[model samples]
Target chain A: MSRLPPLVPGFVAAGLVVGIIGASLGALFVVGSGADGSILGDPYVRRIVVFTLWQAGLSAVLAVGLAIPVARALARRRFPGRTALLHLFGLPLVLPVIVAVFGIVLVFGGHGWINQALDRLSLGPLGSLYGLQGILLAHVFFNLPLAVRALLLALATVPGESWRLAAQLGMAPAQVFRFVEWPVLRQALPGIATLVFFLCFTSFAAVLTLGGGPAATVLEVAIYQALRLDFDLGRAGSLAIAQLAICGLVAAGLLGLGRSVAVTPELGRATARPDVRRGVGALGDGLAIAIAAALVALPLAALVARGLTGPLSTVLRDPAIWSAAGRSLAVGVSAAALALAVACGLAVATRELRLTYRVRHLATAPDMVAALPLATSVLALGAGLFALLHRVVAVFDVALILVAGINALFVLPYAMRLIAPRMLHVAEAYGPLCASLGISGWNRLRLVEWPSLRAPVGLALALGAALAAGDLGAVALFGTQDTATLPLLLYQRMASYRMEEAAVIALLLMAIAGALFIVLERGIGGREHP
Target chain B: MSTLDLQAVGFRYEDMTMTFTLRVPAGGITALIGPSGAGKTTLLNLIAGFERPVSGRVLIDGVDMAGRAPADRPVTMLFQEHNLFPHLTAADNVGLGIHPGLRLAAPERARVDEALDEIGLAGLGRRLPGQLSGGERQRVALARSLVRRRPILLLDEPFAALGPGLRRDMLALVDRLRRAQGLTVLMVSHDPGDARRIAERTAFVHSGHILAEGPTADVLGPGATPEVADYLGEHV
Candidate 1:
């Protein structure tokens, strides 16, 4: 059986990505006049860039800084539901962006639950839901759980032998962290922090909704504002270029994170982590878990609580809501299918590339290809696509397709995370067998590869779908009255002070997002084989 | 008589360099006995076409198999473990030897069944590799090699994981297969007793060089090289 050379898929993936991001930025450069000093000369653009960096920086620092204690607590403690707690912390991964933002709003809004509590306690109602605080709150809300889980994984990876040694030496808790924990965390922290930073920096839908006004704008919002509201294509192009430069720099910085901490393979031979239960440490860990749990759970509770208001029948009967939900389902399914195809191709191709090239750097190439697009804000992607397609077809007419394409690209890194490692493992284990047995090409895929990859491949598709279902970035730029997705419709309803409809739609979007995730992750995908 | 030859073959992995010039007479069994990390496995890999030698020819029956893929080589190898896909049943794994597609004709299927039954795994063809005992697993692997109908077989410690009694049985099976098929066999083992049991000739590989190659009794006889004498210890 013959197959194409391994580099073909990666090159195709890289090409499509370059064509999209490159054409977006290049066309902007071509069409727009030299607005070289736009970030400095234009006061509005200057404010937006500063705020974008300021919020992402603050969010990254807070997410990681706070996650350290929470993650350590989870790692060291063997409390009941510890596993469930870690899974809960991953909720934001499947929850759509708008649903998360809605949850945040319901908790932090002026008339929301937290403000009501403050008023009852005679602490002045904190109207923190509409500006810089709102943006940072949502960012932290989304990223803190992820940061904690990542850090916990980092903490657990500190070889069991090291823990036994620390215990045998009777090292104090602080000393244990300093000598043992800190080194592992230090290795993993940069990647997690930089990832969180890039995500917040490319903030779109959440920023679009919570930005309050021009006073708290980000570069992404500015691009959308220029293109959609002002119809200033030149200004939008300049802003898109500016955003890419800043994001590209951050993405490059992210590539430097310490990686692949070799798991000391001596298993069953090493003793279990020196069973720890000191009084002071136990008390402190309990406190950390309590605080983190409350911080993560309250907003989700608020989303459900705030949504049960307004006549339930009227809320469900709204035809626009049903239509928006239908559109979202279609878009999510289509994007997931598209993203899975792309992710599988790139992963398999990368496996081939690694085999043919036999270089360590090329092994990490697929990850970089997947991640580079992540740093390119979808708003900028939207602006570029709009410019290119506006030349041939009307921008609004192809809005759904454009949004699906962007969301697919946006969800790609996550899909690759599920796919690439397992693909490489399969290639390593079976490459010789395949070579020896004359199993190659489509037959190899059908007989050998598919049986192994089905689970992770299914998981990747599900995650892709969930992310697409909840996308607000591209939808906000191109969404029209005729073709508005649930997220866009939810945002529009919130903008018009139809809080009743907004709440209902918020719950609906969350349910849909959560349902797709559960169905695909649990129902479709089988247990991952080692 | 078919011959298996390695003509000045050389391979380098990391810091270790291995060179070989060897010949195996048709139907003779050569035991490659070495300490661990002595490149015995690497030599087998080269001959099986899993890896290419840096220099010279791997000539099987007067044909230089320089550019042949592993599947194209007239050799079959059984690794120490993982010789069969865990997902495939014993029959299916054996069927892969005859046709990798595992889409055997009715007669070919009967042949696979017969091979299994001959290996004393008649009713176990439906069992996955994981379900089989260590000795049974290697029997399945050996049976697969038998179905391949290759003239030369390279077995790298195929029964190393089996117990002493089971190891003897597996070696007997190899001997039976070799005599019946007139197969030229090269088997790597750390145990000198294994060479005494089945091999006609024994080759001692130590740190990238072959220390001795002769009839097993002569090589392990009193006049053996000091290094070989020292290594074989009591097992010889």
Candidate 2:
């Protein structure tokens, strides 16, 4: 343990993280070499970058800004269905992007429920839900819930003592918010904003689904156009570099976030919040909560309504849908298993290395393993691997393996985040005893480490499975007629204007994804705390 | 049993630096007493191979422990708490000492049983650590060290979590186990009464230096070093 710095596991973990970055970089180099450097002069590329940044920045700002009031309202008012509402807010993170996109379309599309209602009102069908407006709507739909939950957690962590003191001093709600609640939200803002921005920045399915024409094209869509439509690998490479440069700057900006505020005992949120509701305050909070609920709930409700209105039996009879659903299951399992193993190994190795060495430089490697995927759009990652593999094997021949591998890489960061803290905690608490007892290698892991790791392992597996099952980024790029995943199948159905069949396929996809998450999440033990 | 040696050992954490050079006879109980943040625990970690000293040798029976990992070294330590895995039964936790993977044969199981009985936890071996009291957990930790059979044992404030009576009782148990196992021991205790109870020699550490070392009585007596006298103020 001491002599060699736990090189075997350390290298494996670092290699997993570095290899993905390298593969993406290798793709960049391969493609960029053939680049004519004509991107700046091209109007289409210009519009792509402009729309990409515009939509992403707007989505992040709007999501986080709107989440503040929703979180604050939820924090103060406890109701019958509050916990259920909280859980509902977590749904979008696990839902397939295509399903959510279709849901947005159902609520806001040209012939959707909203437009039909407007038609009856003689409002002339209120414009189409395809372009910047629809793209932003879809982004906000997917991310608002995430931002709300993040802010809500931060709000909950505000020391109850502060609330007590605020009440004692007879502070108004606005004053209380300014003096007390604002700090916690401000501290959490950077991390939450960065996460939402990256998610929207790398968005794939919604961009192509809602965003039509060059004016609405994003960088990811541009890369797809280059690689899949035009067969221009060189242009895709140059666009990837551009995307990578922006991501690098964003990551650098986020470096200061870690040191900002750690959840501390001084926060001391052990006590309950003091009730300070009065007349207007209660009404305002009520209004805020209702609006947020409607904003998040309407699209999902529309999705369900529209999905059930279709010829369900016809969609069920489609063999392609069944084949793709089965394929998605297999790919998700493979991805989750691979991600879990890599994340577990990295957590162990980082903890071990922390013990033997004082250089914390190695610590960030595990986190970076997952972060790389977020920074590089899934389109870039898939194109990189696809280009390199296209040299040896037909791209579709190893589609399942490639999808699983890339999926694992994508989720590795999250798994690392979920599991690494517990691993370090176990090491800190038991490292001395384990070392003194001559416990090392597999024996230590089996006897001392495994007990505390069960919950985190369960979490990692479930998260990986659910996320991979819903993922359409890389799948959309690499999928062919024979190798389509569930999301891709749904997209294909929608492309053919078979809205009824697409809705049915969306329901089935949601069912399978949700079931996979619940079963694996509960399968390991009595309860999972993550 | 083997003698413990810290020859010209120097280590630092952040701005704190500590240097040590001492030898203790085999199979004896030596207590480390110190002021707060005086590197008492860090010294124990160095001895247990949790950390390496900057410029010296950690020799166990004259063999340089240069490249040996904490697990490879011949030592066992009892922490203040977190001594037992909550997920493991008491028997399995103690069994881990005999074999890392708990691949205990019939004879090894007997030995684990014997160790449990010796710690007055014979029937409670089937229970988890969480089911036991504070004193019972410490006993379980001792039982683990007993089964480990390492020539040297280190204790880092192991009894700090227990009440006075329990602490005294556990110190007595350590003395008894030391005599039975012929184990060389260095235990960290902040209370002078604890050093008075079990230790033969007392090492007074302050500001990262061994300010005083002798028989426990002489070190804590009237004519002690001024630093030791000040540390063991009127309270002691």
Candidate 3:
């Protein structure tokens, strides 16, 4: 018997599992909802859709809007520890969303330090931090760094030759920006804006924690409420279908927009650092730096401080915290493995397929798939899955499946980003050779493709695992008292006002997540230098 | 026998209605020379089978290859930017030409080693493309094509980055290899001198039309049209 390639079996197995699960869940929703016509008649459903759009739109705009100046400053200025700072700005990208929400609440909530300080000044008590405003605040806090990182990366893309030409022409700073920097940023903005918009739109945990009521709820929250709170399977199904339709439409639109904006070659040369010599520019740069720093630092500082001064020792000693942490680790590892496996399949398929018009569309599938989960929140997805799976699986088993599903969906984007570029490059560079040698299937992947993808694969797994570890949403929907993950445990602690214990867990989560990312990056990245 | 033949081959971009057509014979360097936007690179892409033409036919040794994908085409392309996989060693890059699917045993590895050795990069197989100099990268790319043993080779200004001396040396090496392998070579070049140095025949492309085609010396001579002259003057 001829031995089949290992990757083929791996791909088939993973694809079948994911496809079956996704399809079965989707089918269940359709079947459970007897109304075949349209799901638009329900006022509750319409409200959820409208609410989702509003919050996502507001959050995306604010995140991207604030990111512009900060990005410009970071791009132009060369301050001390700029490299470290740039890395810090990007840190939140991999930081679990749950952790970020905790950090946000600690600093910005009504009972948070900021509100307490405002009160001390005899300012009338600020309104509750559990509504539209709070959701927007959390979105900004989480995504602002992402916006800055992406935009700064884009701003740094202006060619040094362009800068030199501007200098030779004796162009002013504003003129330099007008001619040199504007074009690059303009090219990059639409894609970045759309990315941030979609991220905010599908946000689960942020909305869950901060949303005050049905009126204030986003689509994802509404889906959770329908399933978990009301046990309304029919309503949940309709909402899921609606969420998919809306998010799918936006994703398609974004993909079209993305195609039109051709990615230009990254200019590798270094430009002259920002000259903060004058009054306004210097002050502007300073303000930008300060604002960027405070946005990230304030919440983190509050979390750390709260951990240190309050019930720190008691939280550490709690056995529930340890158990939850262990469960979180297990779930994270499984999710990462699943995501990596999916990414590998997609990458291989991309390579094996010929670049026809049809294949070009297929190539973008992973992007859309990765972004889909983000558009519909993990909580909503879990709820949808929970309602669907109730027919065949036990609730406890369903929770684990939901956790895995959410993690897989969350990590897909990172995995795609990590693996696709390298995979495409290899295929472009080496495909003809491989093809000519008749290396169509498994052996090609094993001997030729795998070695090249090793670093990217490892990084993808690390990123996927880190993301999964920090996720707090889906678990909340499906979690039993026994199945509690770290994020759930931390939330439990926070809800019970065990500030010290939550803080320690949050810190520990960050360390584990950060350490995993570092280890993978170093492991893969070290090969180049050594 | 001619290893490659393009019989009224044509290509058009997705947004465009216009189709380009060209025909080139095999077994020696045929330079496709033109100004920017004149469809020179497009011609190479079509020949390499990277882009399928809307209406035309390409043949490799009398086999119609119009609908064939790049991988299936008996043609290897050396892009201008030296698209050597950055992470792979020079020898590994060369060995890729042997294709792992061939499950090339020890003997095939020996052939790859021999090709690299022939190109004066005998012991540098362990070094990645990033570590190699531009000229060396070009050599590695050349060695990869040589190892592939494909009858047709497409050079998209592969030697455009080399220094004057290195360019001449590489051109000479390509000439010798083409003769030895009896390879059909189609190359795109902005440099008239490059065309003259390497091509047995040259085709002048302008506005997606092959304005002139014949012996390299005759096509590049003063009798050439003002547009071709202008294109050559600016580049060469």
Candidate 4:
């Protein structure tokens, strides 16, 4: 009887994740069930719940609605920096959220660039940048690029043959969109929309900083408030469960929308789109591209300009700022290492279980486990761990570790998405050769796995570091005076109306996150060495 | 080299149950020609210990190969592509045959050098697979197989990606190596001409069964069975 290769490491890693998430959820249920009344009975709680759905729904609708034209324009046109623009779209995903929000405030605030232009034109100043509109602007600023990238990936899947057929028949622009593009768009639209909506729904830092009052409060922030401000464990637990259910539904909607759209290998081949060359349509495409680019770029430009012109000397003199930066660095690096290790374990096990053992169900289990954080909100996990660990161990003592662990889970899905497929591809291609040559264990890893996995693993680590460094959710829940990282520090400055100080901190945060991203990507994920 | 025998080997792929039985002579070339998905590669995989037989023994020189791993069997195989690691230098790839770690002693290193010389890639061992031409990459893979010093060599259309002239040259190189080392070779080919060029014996595989087996000229000639004739219709 032939025995299967040991899959213990992957399963053990996956089990640890399951135990962490499952125990957290169990704690939330226990605390929530003990509450005296329905958490939704209070009008304020109901309003917060309703507003959470309202903002997320509107944000997703607006982002995805705007992304369609922008994606089409991008797909049809080719120009200089086109590839750079696509890479820029990837930035918003890993870019620090608080930094971008500062950028939004600088560009769209009452005394900012756009209002200054409006006032110069004899138009009155637009009102405050601290309400529902502020939240929507920030959400779209972050998600529009994301939606465009996703849709562009979808558009890339349109076969060169289909484009050739369309060109041969001389299909007009409208006919081409209707016949060829719309079907692909229709399939990808739901998945992108759900992703955007889920992101906005669970957003904490943007909503907290810009929420202004109870009118703009989201469940994520409300849970934070119930735990930290009100010291009401019951309300926090109830809010965590509500957020979990809604996120679970959104995740299910995403999975239900998943259909395996067949992609031919002849992707990225130079297929000139028939209806989009040197015409009025080309002019419109250029216009769409410009507007989308401006929407993404202006804020970042304003951020750097405002930050460079802020109170540089005073902010630099502050010891708290430097310390916070150090702590953020520590958390970022540790989180990245942990995230990559867990993701690799899950990916290797998933590949081996599927290909070697032929255990289909177990192969997919690690992926599901890796995706747990998407359904279980980071704030929910934070609240549960707080409830479970507060009495036994001082949560404040191990605050950095908690934040890093939770952040690893937060970014686990992206890590798995980026790493698993590449690993599987390497396995499928070289597995038989390696097996025939007795290249197992460390020999296989060093000679075979590392060479192929370096790029994706570097990407995962860089993204994980940047995202974790900029994260404000778990840190907000656990951050005491000593544990405040750069994002938390920036939030504190912004709250106290220290706009100039916030500007410098924002710039510093962006620099730190950007440096980590570049260093990890370049240092570890070096150019595919020949 | 040793004799290879498949004694009523049975495998179920999806809804199809395939049964194969063939005796490949020692130190000789046996070519498997069939329609696509007609179990040509499967037969080679069974002999290489990559797939297990459900109902019969794969006897390599009268020793049952059941439960033996692919590496434990005295076999080497080359696929159409990915025969050489794209990232490794030609010499390092060949040296993997000597030690999976590529930690070779001086004599083993000399053996790698000698194998590369035999395959006409003598001084090109430091180049990565990306730097080598398609035919040269196959030559590198052939060198690795030579250094492995395995008794059985299975080729799953290893030269299918090359042009006709390159393919002919590679076949001649294989014939030379087979003659020098006395290695038993079982090669699968879609092109009957590949078998006619150098294979001493040819087997016509049709719908999961060996329909015809004999000297290469007769099996690939007008005397073939109807299924074989249909499969080889235009080529023959």
Candidate 5:
């Protein structure tokens, strides 16, 4: 009897992922068990924990609360550049966290645009843009757009028939919202809230920069401090465990909610919302959309303006900045390559189980492996790996490798999401035809699958590269003075109050990410449709 | 050409346990007609080695086809849609039949052109599937199947997506190919008119069983079985 080869590549990759995660967790437990409880009981540690929960909860509430009107306005209106505005909302997700924060500082800081405007008006300038308010502002800036996109998706799912009925019945704006939109929006609310909370809970670069001092520290920054600032492995280990436990619980809740945050919103359905055409309601929607657009656009605008205006020629000549940029480029390309390989294997295995073997439940096993880094925070994973490797090798020697590897795993879920749907479609549509035609293995991949899969695979690679290029999470834990990436270099500049140089670096990093996205997507993807 | 036989071949799909037994004499067109979800397609899949039966055996020319993969089996099939890869040109898609890699020597390349000529698609081999009409796409698939030259050809409603006039033209083309190549044809179709047009033998498949079998005139005539009449009634 002829037998298909055991899905060796896919299974081996999956097993390796599981083994790495298992070893990381095992090392964490071992180190954590040896640690004393004194660190957990410290007043500063307790404050950090409380502040972490407070900030995440407040961020989730504020982001979602503000997103409702914006999403509603977008749902009802059909203006020019509406699609462009929605696309702009997707920028915060791929934009480097530190760059956005630097932009926030430029716009809202003491000597920033707002304060300058206040000074010119002879109204006293605001006192500060630090502490809780600054942290909240940055968090909301990142997450409000995310919330708006998610809510926009929910609003799009409101069947067109409901809108038609509302118009026929002459339902008022408030009545249409209550009768038609509320039910669908409420159902989608919890999942978006949980996702936003989880993101804010594990936030690293944003809080690390805007968090003025210890009073506003989150657990991720605390882990960095405990590990790097004090050289206290015990404290770091315990804090890492604590953060993992909380994040795991939140992630479990997210899974129970049965929604993965969508990175790209589906094409918005054009429902004819005729209830609020040109009354006060129309004016209100326009205002809501205008404010949300400015909120998302201003920081990015400030980043570009400051970047072009500040020491561009000198920063371009600095060798340290160039070396850091080179290191970041290396890490990003390596991470993208590794991530695409693993995502392909997992996607192939998943299609085999789902289509050929017909075991729907078992197909999700590979997906679970891909999603492992999500449940376990990236910093925790890094600290655990550091502990595991410290006894055998110098951690500094393998910093780039560790950072790239973890970032690959960190981006694996997104890569898989992008590739798996298209890969399965290619297999399902052509499997039997290929089978009857004696097309299998390399022939099938080259002739049948490659033509259909290249576009999505290129997109996956591009996104992975951009996300990894600007990553500061795992690199912060593993980086030394000699091994600093661009984001790390930018962070150091910010910490030491070299605001001018930092702006230049932030702009450079942003440009690198954008260029990587375009190059990989276009160079590999070939064309939009093909 | 080959004689195809199913000897009490059994399959379990979800809660349904289907057992089918049938035979088609060599070098003739045999059509299996039934209501939707009546195991007609499953029967074709079993014979083409696309599906494995739970019990008994499928024999081609009296040899048990049990341990052969679909590719190794002496059969070819054309699905309802996606018969050609969207990216591949017509010539390359047909060339796959001669050698899976399209590594054609002079004579092998000539065979692809000849098959395309037979299917009336000559000189259009450079066009991709997206550039072809619905009828042209199915003809291209027929051309590929002709080049494969398998003794048995299974058509799983290959022309169902076409309009009536186009479907009949495709059926006439299949009839000509079958006669010219001396191929055994087992076709699954929903329309009884498909059987009336070219199929000499017809089998009524119902509830995973061959409910009736005979000449097409006798089976589909006015004095048919009650179940067959009822099924035909629904279509009308």
Candidate 6:
């Protein structure tokens, strides 16, 4: 009789709790109807659904479509600043949405430098930079890097051995994609598309700032107005339910697609020389690099220049700016810690449960957490929590809890997404060995799992922290005259037309977020000698 | 006493409904030679207590160990890829078998040193597994089993990656270890030469069933099934 490995009941219990929480939240959309026609009768609800779907679809298509050519160029060619360019793609993964939006606005807004230059050249100041176009443009800006990363990662997976084989077979560039690259890209497409679509659908800050009017409003924006502006509980509840249904369906589809697709290994080690060497191909490659660089670099450069020329020094002197910066730091640290805890719990749970039904259900928690913050506006969440608990709780106390909760919720998906792959890899490769060694419970985690996951875990933490620090969403709802975050303060300065002050704060925010990410990533990940 | 016994032991993979059964005598090296997809590794996993058989019993020293975990079952497995903990030193990898956690006291270090010396790795205890060559890693794995002193040692193509010279040296070491410790060895190999070199008994398995089992010489000799003969390359 072979001995059965001892099951850790704690991990199982944690899984059960996460499962219950996700199911109950999902059920809330089904059972309750407060104002928007008992979850089924609201015509306004239909519009919200269509708007959300449209924006997400358009954004994902544009981002990924543009990314393909850029990825191919990157994969083939060697250039100065290529490594820096690769790292640039990772910036948006950690960059705060609000900060990125602010950067976009500086370049594209009516009175912004782009329009100013156009006006000087007698181009008549190209039409209004608001509504559907603005939101779609911002979405593309935010997600283009993500799409590039996913596509490049896929392109990298094409083995050099396969490339050598293709060369030996005298395959052309078209033939290479037809056989070698197409299959990998096809395999990676669903995952990349799903991730981008989910990101766009849940987009809160971008929609709120860029959507020109009511006709262009997304579901998350409606949820916010229903709660914060009107204080209408029923309408807010209905919107929440509607948001849940749409996000749930999309998430389920994504999960199903993700399961069917097998993850391919990364392509052979990167080569310094260009893969393509022909006339038209060379021109196309050059154009792709030039466009990708301009698209990412222009706004970033404008923001930095604006900071140098504007009220950076005055903003630095303001105690409010310093306090808000401090608050942002605190929130970021707390959110990162909370996100890590939840991610670890989910990972351990997924490992312990053998039943497919239970595993699939728990797997959705991280996705939900990631997408929910984007789907349901931060203002709406703050309003919902306040309404639910305000009868017994102090407003200020609830405000801080809401801030931390939103930040944690917003960052949870990235942590889970980052950690899940690494954890699964470790489990697939090492679980049997650990089980055979009777290395169960915390001992197994500390000795076997932790060592392998150290790099990914550190990266996840850095990303979560940076996102939290840069977040401008919940701050609008919970931030008081006294408790503003750096982004909130920047917005306040911008609102008062203190353009100089806002510019400085923007630069400082980017610097802090970037610096923190670098320090943490290097400190933890550097421990691995190789 | 017989070191290991299997009573009607059977295993079936969940993905497919095929079943495999096997039994082996104690003390000598029992080689399970088979084509791919023949459930050779499954049989090894079952005996090492890494996987539980769907039905029947496994006994070590006449005691039923059906519910015993791998660590508690007096069995050790050496894998093909050498799953040495990369962070730990070579001696520490061997030391894990005896202490499980490599938490050795003063006297245990001497025992570890002696085990390392016995495996011809005497002074190389402090080097990490990454620093060791392929042959050295396998020797460390062998030393690990020695330190554990487990009656049953399961080898899953542990020598498949080594050069011919090192493979022979390791086989000689395995023979010496079996003689010195009376360890009951069950090894899975595709190479007929490996089976003939070390195993006393060989089992020819195909399609999840043991087609034949007997002394190594007989199994590889005349009148064997054409599949077995082809597998052994009798024409060569």
TM-score of chain A of each: 0.92, 0.92, 0.87, 0.95, 0.95, 0.85
* Model 5, span A1-530: residue lDDT tens: 57555466688879878889889888888887788765568788788889999999999999999999888988888889998998899888888888888888888998888888998999998868888888889889998989998888888876654464344233467766765677678888899999999989999998898888988989999888878788877677778888888888998788778655667655576665645568898889999899888878988998898888989999989888898899889999899999899988888899988997899999988887787777888788887887788999999899999989988998888888888888889888998999999998889989998888888888788889999989998888889888899999888888898989888999999999889887998888778632
Candidate DockQ values, in order, are 0.01, 0.01, 0.01, 0.01, 0.01, 0.01
lDDT tens digits by residue: candidate 2, B1-236 = 88999987899888988898778789999999989899888888788765778988899999999866555678888878767655568887788777654568999988888999998898998998889999998899899888878889898887898899988988888888988999999999989998988899999998888888889999998878888888888534
Give the poorly placed runs of model 3, Cα more than 4 Å off. Answer: A5-14, A21-25, A35-39, A116-127, A258-269, A273-277, A355-377, A430-451, A524-530, B1-236
Give the per-residue lDDT digits (tens) of candidate 3, residues A323-410: 8778777788789888777767766566544343336655555555544454455655665566667778797766766787677876
Residue pairs whose backbone atoms clash in candidate 1? none
> Candidate 2's interface RMSD, please?
22.8
The TM-scores of all predictions, comma-separated, are: 0.67, 0.66, 0.64, 0.68, 0.68, 0.63
Residue A35 displacement (Å), model 5? 1.7
In terms of docking quality, how is candidate 3 classified?
Answer: incorrect
**In model 2, which runs have C-alpha deviations exceeding 4 angstroms?**
A1-5, A120-124, A259-275, A433-448, B1-236
lDDT of 2 by residue, A1-530 (tens): 35555657657867866876787688687876678856666776777777788899999999889889878878888777777777777778788889989887887888887898998888888677888888888888788888887777787765543453343223456656755788678889988888778778888899898997777878888888888899888888888777777877776665545422121111112333434356887788789878777767877887787778878888888798889989899988889888877777777677766776655887666666655565666777777876677778888877877888888888777777777888899889998898899998888888977777777777677778888988887787788889899998888888888898888888888888888877877785227354
Question: Model 2 misses residue A100 by how many Å?
Answer: 0.5
Candidate 2 lDDT score at position A179: 54
Docking class of 1: incorrect
Give a tens-digit lDDT track for model 6, residues A411-453: 7666767676677677778878987989967887789888888
- As for TM-score, the candidate ahead, 2 or 4, is 4
TM-score-best of 2 and 3:
2
Interface RMSD of the predictions, in order shown? 22.1, 22.8, 19.2, 21.9, 24.5, 20.8
Model 2 chain A lowest lDDT segment of ten: A259-268
Candidate 2 residue pairs that clash: A370-A413
